[model samples]
Target: MAARAMHVLTSRVGEHNAVILSQEALSNLVGCSERRLRDAVKLLAAENWIEIRRIGGRGTVNAYVINDRVAWAGARDGRRYSLFSATVIAVDDEQPDANELGQQAPLRQLPTMYPGEGQLPSGEGLDPPSQPSLGGLETDLPARRISPPAGSPFDDEK
Candidate 1:
């Protein structure tokens, strides 16, 4: 029983030292029924070999700490999801890593914005067009944006 679960656990383990996967996925990785995988998780937790945490329901992913030294791990962030491994990395928001953020990196090297590549910082395209204002005067017009009405489509109904 433990063997099967271990097979599943190790597959999802990573350098971040945390494993978080839904019970169903874990069982699939173990090549056993969900019941058996759950039983194995209980045994491992009871024996102190690992720490498992389950949320409210069955589909919820269970978090694990294989390294016995870590008794508790901070709740993982929702953005840290893994598709193939079913792992959710625990991150320290206080001290963030640029690599970890990747494309979403806050301080990424700005993309090449040559004179005519894309829109300029001022919202004008590389070819800034000149406009004639009301009284035969030439002036630059600021980019105009039109926003939808107050309530967003996602807003709940009253």
Candidate 2:
């Protein structure tokens, strides 16, 4: 069960920087009830395998921080294990050039998804140029996919 929960958490790490799994979500993923999930989480917390933080006003939405070192140790000893790193890199928001946007252009803003809003177009939601669909393209032409072989560079002599 612990291994199953860990797998789900790690899979979502890319979408969420910090692995924050709600008890209900964990329960659903592990095929257990909320009570069982809570108990398992408590045990993991006691073993320092995860750090749980309760958010005020957010019902059952707890933040879980995975401890990779402890999880690895447990795995080595044939116990339930989880693997994750808590290290976080600070991102700098400074723009490359202030003058890149001319005075005529309005200040740039981040895109937001409102409740009733439909799915935004791809490319960061920025307006894209209207182009004809490629559905009518000729499919008879041969398509060549190029890639380097295992452990070999593109220019390898061999």
RMSD (Å) per prediction: 18.7, 17.8
Query: lDDT scores for all predictions?
Result: 0.61, 0.58
Model 1 per-residue lDDT tens digits across residues 1-158: 78778765776686655587666666666788878887888898888888766544764567777765444344577433332222663433323574655465376344344543334445435533433234664445677766645697754542
Stretch of 10 with least lDDT, candidate 1: 78-87
Task: Determine which window of 10 residues in candidate 2 has minimal summed lDDT.
Answer: 86-95
Off by over 4 Å in 1: 55-59, 68-86, 89-158
TM-scores of the models, in the order given: 0.43, 0.40
Question: What is candidate 2's lDDT per residue for 4-33, written digit by digit as tens?
Answer: 666666666564435554566668877988
Q: Model 2: what TM-score?
A: 0.40
Listed per model in order, the count of residue pairs whose N, CA or C atoms clash below 3 Å is 0, 0
